[model samples]
Every structure is written in C-alpha cells, then in structure tokens.
Target: MPDRLDPKRQFLADLFDAAVAAADPRRILQDVLPPPPKGRTVVIGAGKGAAQLAQALEALWPHPCEGAVVTRYGYAAPCRHIRVLEAAHPVPDAAGIEAARVLQSCVADLGPDDQVIALICGGGSSLLPAPPEGLTLEDLQELNSALLASGAPISVMNDIRKQFSTVNGGRLAALAHPAPVLSLIVSDVPGDDPGAVASGPTVPGRPAASAVLAEVTARGLELPPRAMAFLQAAAEQAPAAPPPSRSTTRIIASAALSLDAAAQRARARGVNAWVLSDAIEGEAQEVALVHAALARQAQHSGFPHPAPLVLLSGGETTVTLRHKGRGGRNSAFALSLALALEGQAGITALAADTDGIDGSEDNAGAFVDGASAAAMRAAGVDPRRLLQGNDAYAAFDAVDDLFHTGPTGTNVNDFRAILLGELPDG
Candidate 1:
C-alpha cells in the first residue's frame, strides 16, 4: 500500500472523493425539492441511499412529511419525520418483503391533493422486493442470485426483474394514482434512465413479458417453476402500455455528473484529465484490458492525449462467476488491469463503486499500479491464478491495496481513474 505521503495515490483518492462529494444528497437535494403540497406529503423510497436521501429531504423541506423508506443494512441515516427501515441488498430478505409492503401502504389511498415523494437509488431492486402473485420471496431471491452470477448487464437484469415484481415497472407509482408523485432519483445505471433505476418503481414502462422471458432465456437463468410460470402467463396476456400516473422523475445525481466533477478536480490540480465515458459496460476483465490499452497509448505514443493525463470512466460491469470469489466487478477490473499493465512503468489506477460497497465485500474495490502484479508475486500470490479463480479481493489484500470506504451515503455506480506517466505538480 502507498504511504500517506504518496502523492500519486493521494491525487487519485482526491479525485474519487470529489466525485462522491458531488453526489451527496445533502449537497444536491435541496435545489430540486418541489413546493409544499396542499395535502399530506408522504415519503417512500428503497435503495442503499434512501435513508440519507430522506434525511436530506427532512432537513430541506419545512412542511411536515411522514412516511417510510427502506435501505440496505447498515446504511440507515437519521431522519426526523421519516421512518428508516433496513434490509438485505443484492438479495431480497423477509425484512425487505415487509418493507415493500410498508412502502406500498405509504402511498395507498392518497388523494389527488396529497403528494408522494420517492427516493430511489441503486441497490433498490433487491432492497425493495415484491414478487408477483404465485411466486415466493425465495423464488425472487434465487432468481436474483442467479442473475448476479450470470454476467448480464444491470439494465437487462432489471428488465427481467420487472416482469416478476408486483411493485416495480411503475406499479408503485400506479398505486398512488390520484396523488402526484415526484421521484427524486440517484441514477446508478448506464444512460441514467430513471425507469431503469430501481426497476422503475415510480416511472412507468415495462418491456413486454415476452421480451423479458427472451432475455431471461438468453441469460440462461434457471428460475423456479412458479417464477417461470408467472412470466409465461404475463407474456400470454395482451400487450399494453402501463397505466400512466401523475409521476415526475428527476435524476438528481448520476455517473456523468460525478465523472465531470472528478475531471474538474483533476484539472484544478494542473493534470490533464479526460472523461472517456460515463457508461462503459462489458465484462469486467475485458473492460480493464481496453482501459489498459488506452493507458499504454497515452504513455508510449500520446495518441489520444499527452502523457500526465488521467482517464476517467464510469459504468456498472458484470462478472461471470467461474468460482465463488470474494470480490466485486470493480476489484476484478483492477486485478485484470494490474496484469495488463505488468512491466510498464509510471501507470496508476483506481476502480471502485461510488456507494462504497462492492459485492457484499468489505472493500469498495482495489487500486493497481504497474507493479501491482509483481507485488502480488512477491507476496507469494499469483495475480493470474487469482484472477482466474475470481478472487481479486485476496490478490489485492495480499498487496495491501484494497480500497475501503464503508458507506458513502450515495450511489452513482462505478468510478474509475487511470493516470499515465508522472503526476503533475500543483
């Protein structure tokens, strides 16, 4: 691990901190709040950042608000008027089942005069599970587990998830038909589509059940019989657009915004920074190889830009589990990057999730330099073997390079930065 005085690592960390700070609810939520409603203002949400988003709303909105929100365990933030509930993430639990009911109840029976404010963020698909009729939570849980290991993109997974859920696909907003709903979203998906985020509980639009089934089949996920039956029946029904509601969605934060913030911070420090893309998605290792190729281009030929530049990109990546590894897509990308950049000099990179939790692991992600692969070998660990085993966590840990930041009270998906050549002086 780099010491506290390591200028290169510190610079990269500063850029990441700036990106996360840009997405903090307290800092960005105040400006977009709607006017006080005529009737009751009920807040209901589900995600890793739902609690903090509720707390931010409470701090900003002077009008009395009452309701509940569900978040991942250990991510609850204090709220004065809104109730915060905790549940499992990446997989639904019984607590999530109950919380989903509570969320539905909050918006139920609301009149046109009332207002419903939904705080949606990443991890909500699992944090708020409402399986359709004839399907059990266990079925949903099993499907979720399989999807995570199937190496499918998040958008595809959510598309299929909407077919089997009672609350998603704008059903949550449909419940509060007469009431006006304002969905304040922190987008964690590629393209920042509000409907795609959290499976679009508040936003209306669902692919035909037939299309969803095709996606499921393409992914080769073996859902339970009841779950499969449910999809088939829905597909047999007449295709129709979801009922519209008085729902308006606004993306309060996203990977593009966060990447812009990081790039600005890098520029202020005199480093030439370029944001490659905020929606790069693919297999984790393959994405890392592309990034490595770009870095080498900048280092040797300066084709895209001169040396002393940091390449920034953000997007969710998927990993096909060849083994039961203890790492997320970000760590896998970092490990692959380490091997790809082996024997090169003066290249450093960081890949982590902005929400500060990756794949139920302790560290958000990992940091890799040109020498990271060699360092692992020095510690009696082969980087290639670990990568093949899908155990980047152990490889990075052996070199003391795992990045940890607990929970950052926000979610904007992946954050990655690669600096080639030498660090620029302030």
Candidate 2:
C-alpha cells in the first residue's frame, strides 16, 4: 500500500495546487479570447505571465498573428511567431528599455485595420519601462528602488510610476488608437483595476499628478529632480485619457477567483474552508499577526468556522525591507506567524506566491506547524533574530520547511492557508 498522506497536509497542498491551476494562462486565455480580427493582430504584453499568455494566444489563435511580449528572465515561453523577450522586473534594466522600444515601435505604424491584443498582468510596470523625456533609465531605477522599499501600497507606487513612464497610463493603447485594442488581463491588484495592472498600459485611469507628489512627499521620498519635474508636468496635463474607446478589456483571472477555487477543493476533502478577504494587505509581519489571531478565534470561539476548518486568503502583502534579508514577504509572513503561534498544537500553515517566486528569493515561501517553534529551538535558530533581520528564508531553511515550487507560469498574488484542529483519522 502507498504511504498514507496526512489529511490536513494533503488538503493544504491540494488547495495550493488548485489555486495555481486557476491562474494558468492556458486556461484563462480560453475563456477571454475575442474572435480573430479580419485585420492584422499584434500581441504585446509585459509581466511575469506575459510570455505564458503570449504562448497561449499563439496556440489558440486560429489565424496568423505576430508580436512580442516581455517577461522576467527564466520565465520565457516557447513561441514561434510571437517573439518572447526576457526583461528585468521589480526593477527595470537595459533589456526592459530595449523591450519597451520594441513594444512602442510595434504599434507606431499600425492603422485602423490592425488590431492589438495586450496581455497584461503583474510586473509590467517595471518591464515596460519607457522613462519620460530628460530622464534616463538610471533615474527611474533609483525611484523604483525607493518605492519598493517604502512599503507603499501598489496604488501609490503605480501612481508615481505613471508620471515617469513612456508607455504606461494608457499611452501604449493611445499609441495604437484607431486600431482596436483588446486587453486580456490576469489581475494581481485587490480591486482588479486594469489601470493599476502594469500601470494601465492598455487601460487608463487619471490619478492626479498632484496626488503622486503628495504621496512621495508624505512618504518623505527624495526623488530625482527630473522625476519630480515629470510628475509636476503630468499634474498639469489633462487627466490621462480614459481607457481607449477602441480597447475592450476583460479580467480572466484574479486572486479572488483562485482563492475561491482553493476553498472548493478544501470542501471536497471534507474540511470546512473559509475565504478571508482576498484584498488583505499591509506590513507582512503585521498581517501574520492578524492571521494568527484568526486562527486562535477559530480554535477557541469558532465564530467564523468550527474546528477542522482551513482559512484561505489571497492578496499581495508588502514588507518594508529594513534588514538585509534573503527572503520575500511571503516567507517573512510565514516565519512571523510561526513565532506568534509559539508551538500551539493543531495549526499548520503555508504562505507562497502564485508565481512560484516570493519577493527576490528562489523559494516560493515557507510552511509552519504547531511544533515549528520547538523545531527552531532544537535547531539553534533564533526566530526573533531571523525575523528582525528579515531573514525568514534562513530561519525556514534551517528547519527544512521552506516551500519550493519553482515557476508556476502565472501571477495572481499570494496564497495563504491556515489549518486548524487535528488531522482526520486515517
């Protein structure tokens, strides 16, 4: 007979697998495809999922189409007609600059007869870098570094980014105006705002330039002079044109959809699954504490759900990187959660990114159990010190509990699960 799998552990793993499946571009594309235009079709996108979306489009497209998409290095998809360009993400690089040039040039000459399909998801903000005039790539990079470390919400970050970009804020779609643009999106933001995804390369939203300035000043960020001037100029310009009239956008996948799928899988396995807010955000450590409180509530009061329940949540959380750590927000959340639990029996949790890369680390995230604290103590790893250093990767690595799932070829955000009560008897 096969070795028996722990029911609770198996349920959690299955839930994660289901969540990953829900974000697959191959599946998502099938549902959102518009009919092939009688005119020329051009595919352009940027994000961790761009290449995968490009590949899927190529596979499903019945007519001949051509274009290019940029994705992070090592995230390239196999394609023939559609060029897959690898670019830097979370930070723009030379590759992204060149890729942006290609993107701009692709639609520059298109007429009304041509159609553009923009496959946008997360990370497009950095990958589709087209710095405003008088600003070099370095200036943008410096500003991006500050923004990433600022712990600002995604909305604020994108608002600041729009002023300094050549292609963002619906400029890309504007470039191809008169050409019908269809955007198939895999939303990573809480509200599924298309304008926020990839900074609204295809969709447009008018967040005031003054708002960007206010946010930067409020955060006490010292932006490069050129960046500041760009924001000031944008504030003066008419609001970013509304999403192109020629553009029709559709959200094929989102974090909430994936979380719901996970909950369904848990129910099938005879476990009560409750979906917490799919828009949960904030400091990673603080979010863990909140989750820990929920776990405690379920254990003691059972207000949300009774014992033998699993709490599922999906959202992109941030970590103000104060320490020179070797982990991402998900791992940091897991480590902090383990500390808060303090070996309280009957709780097991896992936190991992849907894209299979958490923060800048290779591992997706980490897992923790009621005995995690004791295990760390026996291993001579100081959880508090690790948490202080933001070295959640090392802390979890020491106990061999880091969750590694490589690239899952999709991005919806973070998926977390906390299981309560004893494992079902075999």
Best by lDDT: 1
TM-score of each: 0.97, 0.95
In candidate 2, what are the lDDT values of residues 1-426, reduced to their tens digit? 013435666667778889999988889998677777778999999899899999998888888898889999999989989899998878899999999999988887787888899999898999988987788999999889878887888877888888888788888888898898899999988888888888988885547787878778888876767777777777787765454547788988999999999999877777788999898889999999999999998899987778789999988888887878889999989988998998698899989999989987888888888788778878998988988898888888888888777788889998999999865554
Q: Which 10-residue window of candidate 1 scores lowest in summed lDDT?
A: 1-10
Clashes of each: 0, 0
Against the unseen true structure, what C-alpha lDDT does each candidate score?
0.91, 0.86
* Deviation of model 1 at 359, angstroms: 1.4
Q: In model 2, what lDDT does residue 115 have?
A: 88
How well does candidate 2 match the true structure in TM-score terms? 0.95
Top candidate, metric TM-score: 1
